[model samples]
Target: MPLLDPARWRLLHGGEAAAVEPATGEALGTFTLAAPSDVEEAALTAARAQRAWATAPYSERAAVLRRAGDLIRRHEPEIGEWIVRESGSIRGKADFEIRTASEECYEAAALAHRPLGQVLPSTAPRLSYTSRIPAGVVGVITPFNAPLVLAARSVAPALALGNAVVLKPDPRTAVCGGHALAAVFAEAGLPEGLLRVLPGGAETGRALVEDPRVRVVSFTGSTRAGRAVGELAARHLKRAHLELGGNSAFVVLEDADLDAAMSTAAWASFFHQGQVCMTAGRHLVHSSRYDEYVERLAAKADSLTVGDPYREQVHLGPVIDRGHLDRIDELVRGSAAAGVRIAAGGRYRDLFYRPTVLADAGPGSVGASPAYGREVFGPVAPVRAFDTLDEAVALAGDSGYGLALGIVTRDTARALDLADRVPAGLVHINDQTVNDEPIAPFGGLGDSGTGSRFGGEANLDAFTETRWTTVRATPAAYPF
Candidate 1:
């Protein structure tokens, strides 16, 4: 009867996950998850060990990352299937998650030896330099959209910088995350305390963030959750890296390629049932070809076959669960009622929301409706046609959230101009908004997030801190 009862999460490394039915818990079949309370203890133990682990040598950290990456590749298929079972993402999508995570690890390894700190030549006789250092034990709260890869964004960087990590994956998708991360560390010979995987709901995450041992919190979740993490971190004066909600914009100029932009927009907006925070939340098209673009996009959105995640033929998958489906439905219906047109989809069923698209909606219709705000984490993409580039740019900035923006056009000047004007953390030219490069920095500007996720040295920046080391010219002279 319950949505997440009998089929529950197993607290890995809390001990062996023996068959013991947790009382009053829900499950899909026979396995019941560990209570949130039990999960907290595991996190505490990891936190206890994180301190010393953060001091591990750079070579050692690099080895750990490389090994973890190897293990991820070795178990890619199993991990992919696990992602589908745990987070409701499709098999192909799951593979993408695992694959992308492996790349992060690989990138982190390269960064481990890439020289983080710099020592500039000082005019004085003192050796004054700045070196990037670890921020102690880090708490990574990853969502289900891209569990494995997103988890690595924090984990790899922290480990590379000699900071141990305690990853608190979203309860719905913690299984694959816990296993995928810990399994690699194990293969790489990282000690238990170096990287710990704990699975639970909000309480588990709260405990980790609020823990004194956790010096930094890198979280990826809803805006509300981001605020919660920020508040908890603030209480203890700990650093918080909040990658929150985003209502991304996809801008299409008249000269843009029809096939390329429409195809990418369809997948970018509704990919993973549109559960991605960076998914195209808004589609702003030029008036010259607005009608044609909307038609192609709507057709693309409508044609996606859904149902089973394991099916190869299915490019679309269910939202995380029925609860997410309900939320998407509510947002869509409310938008429709508020005089915003549901240009494409507002359908819901048992754990399935058909790929949907909404277009020609008013920007301020409901003070940031689904078209402008509210991340519809499902198969819903809203389109708003614009007559001028300025109108498109304004629409992009119309929302409170500005995580990512996608612009499709051939003119280099136009792309560059829009990229400068757009207020998103990430800007994609002639591609989907959801893509992330391992070397380029990814983050949001407003309610989208505070810190960044992917980049060459910036990823390291989020996990590590800078300690100014200076030798004064006059060592004996003190400030008055």
Candidate 2:
């Protein structure tokens, strides 16, 4: 089987947009962007398909998802390359994402056969039960970073639950992540028109969200965009599941092993150029080990190779675009101007920024500072020293965004205690902040998201509606 061509896909219906390579600013291909009319058409078509699909047997639905996973694994190499060129992801990271996406399909397939309802004891001489039904059409809007996996997190589960999908991926990585995914599902025997991939910008997304036929909206992007999506879904009385921006904190206690802490810190801070929502932006180290940890971490950051994403030896890749690169530079420069010590890497060559570390990044209470309060969305780690465990917990819980947090400590009891106190949705005891699995609940709290989890059994809740039923052997006599 050859790679899926974007031009031959089903949902191309508007002006063309150029897909540019972040490494060299070169055009990889031109993709058709979806218009407003296209969005509406897709939604209506999905609604019709979903009504039919929802009646299909669970075994058939699970088979389709399993086949989709098999196809993804077989084409992992080709898909991984597209991810590298289009999203500027390194070879390792791209491969990991492909594998993760494939596993998501398999996991979701299992849910199709699992129980989706319960029977309750009657209260007044009647039988009562509840059944979960599909939400009709799911609107999935994904971001450029980790597009394939993020799309699968919602799309696979929606399909398994008998819902159709209208996916609008980021214009920057449409061909590889969006178009290719639709092609795989189609080849795996999904009903025609059940899954439509619409690649476009904000207008396309808004059209999908506002469409009444689209019953559920699942979005993964920045907080600002998520807020608008949430408001629109609210007005339309549609279900909305949002996974927004994050500023995860990495706490290193006095008893932490410096070597292990350094390695985990580098991975959490610099992977995917730190564009991930769960990337660690703040490092709160105990005062006893602050200086040593900062020095070793800076050395590790300097040792990493930042170059072409296709190269096997390259550890870091370019940002998504020039505008994002400039934004990261501005944040780093502003932090420096605010007296934050730049321990290493405050420079960039084109879109490729060096892994940066800022020491003694003061309270980071202001919006202008990217250390604690703001989401950096770049490969920069800000460090702040805390003298006591209470102070460290305070620092970890300081941010308005409560997505994830990590603590490296030898004391298991203390780690559990701290995890209980932290406001983040995902907490890591002896690990980094960037951990995720297909079977775990994935979401955030507060400004980070709308508190809708999106994995394992959680998907059943997000993509289905419960219908209560009651039955009685005979009607009761009534007197007026």
Candidate 3:
């Protein structure tokens, strides 16, 4: 069977664009792009659907979401394979994404019937209460990396909250991610026009954000693109939930076990080719273990298998595209020239970049070179040595992006202290930097995001609005 059948779904507008398999540069299929007018139409349709969906019975909404989850699980193998072809994810990672996305649908389904109102005391002869209401039309813009999961992160919650959604997925992976999601919901008995999937680039996203009918915008992508979305949403007085980029810091303390740290570090830095936003960009090691840690990490990188994503033993796969591959290569070259020594794999064969580890990439090198300072968004780990716990904390807090931080230590007191001091939104102790759960508050700090989080109870706030109401037994006296 073909990886994707474009005719199985609907398209809004625009010309056709090819969906290329990153692993082999094969043209999976040509898909129709969503134009600006299509975005406008989707917003209008969402507004209409939202009016009815918002008043739907909680049971009805919950049932639909539950069905969607079941469908996703039942078709995980096919969807996972499509994800590998569309987004260049290896088998394990692709399956993980599909499973996570399916779980998100179930988690979100529970929220449908959950309590959404609060009763408050009133000073006068009146009863006061606040109820959560849908934020009208929700515009979701998701990135290619982990597209299915990210879309589910926003779409499921918004739908569960009774808000109709207009999803604009990255053009590169729209078939397996966005269009697939739309089809799943439709099959699950969701009303027509309630969820619209439009695959396109910046123009479609801009149109969705600027559309007056779209009351809320949920975006997950690069910090640069997120900033533009925020600005556009702000100008239109629309609510925006931004999950942007990250340059997470992985700290290895002296008390940490070398073998454990090395294993976690390898996965955190190289998984999904480090295309994940929460991938650890910097490894801050205690001077006591820096040398041995780097040596072990280098060996681990050399052992990883990089080839066909479908192969059971393949550990890594190609990046999203050639442009990104070129960018990763440039960063490695520039960093190498800045006196940063490559301790492990540093070369690229086609779209597959070998997992790379850089030594002596301390504050000086990071600040002096873009490759070290900015989010590399590739399978590269820059290890820096720090003498004191305070220095490690300082180094981790140096970046403008603060999505997540990892601390590997046996001392609970020291770990807690450092976690408190770190500016990141999510802090992990004895774990890798790349982590997420359906019920946790997922977002970042500073340029990493706009202080808005999605997941768990946070999704209720992001996808809904609170309205206060009061009931009076008698007419209130007014001042003359």
Report clashes for each candidate as comma-separated counts: 8, 0, 0
Off by over 4 Å in 2: 9-11
Q: What is candidate 1's TM-score against the reference?
A: 0.88
Q: Which candidate gets the maximum lDDT versus the true structure?
A: 2
Cα-based RMSD of the predictions, in order? 4.8, 1.2, 1.5
TM-score winner between candidates 1 and 3: 3
Error of 3 at 173 (Å): 0.6
lDDT of 3: 0.89
Ranking by TM-score: 2, 3, 1
lDDT per residue for candidate 1 within 1-480, as digits (tens), equals 111222233433333232211111224222233355544565567666666666667787788888778878787766776677666676777777777788788888887776767887877678878888777778888887788888887888778777777787765665666545776676678777667667666767777877777788889889998988889899999988888988888888989889777788887887887888888888888888888887888788677787766544677766665566677788887777777666566775667777877766667755446544677777777777888888888888888887888888999688889889878788888888888767678788789887555567777778788887877657655588
Which stretches of model 3 miss by more than 4 angstroms? Answer: 1-5, 8-10, 365-367
- The true-structure Cα RMSD of candidate 2 reads 1.2
| Preferred candidate (lDDT higher): 1 or 3 | 3
Q: What is the TM-score of each candidate against the true structure?
A: 0.88, 0.98, 0.98
Candidate 3 C-alpha lDDT tens digits along 1-480: 333357854455688888889888888778789999988888888899889999999999999999999988887877887899889998888878878888899999999988989999988788999999999999999999998999999999899999999999999999777988887898889999899999998888888899899999999999999999999898999889999999999999999998777889999899999999999999999999999999999999999988778654689999999999998988888888888899998898899899999988866645465566889999999999999988888899998998999999999789999999989999999999989899899999998998899998999999999999999988889996
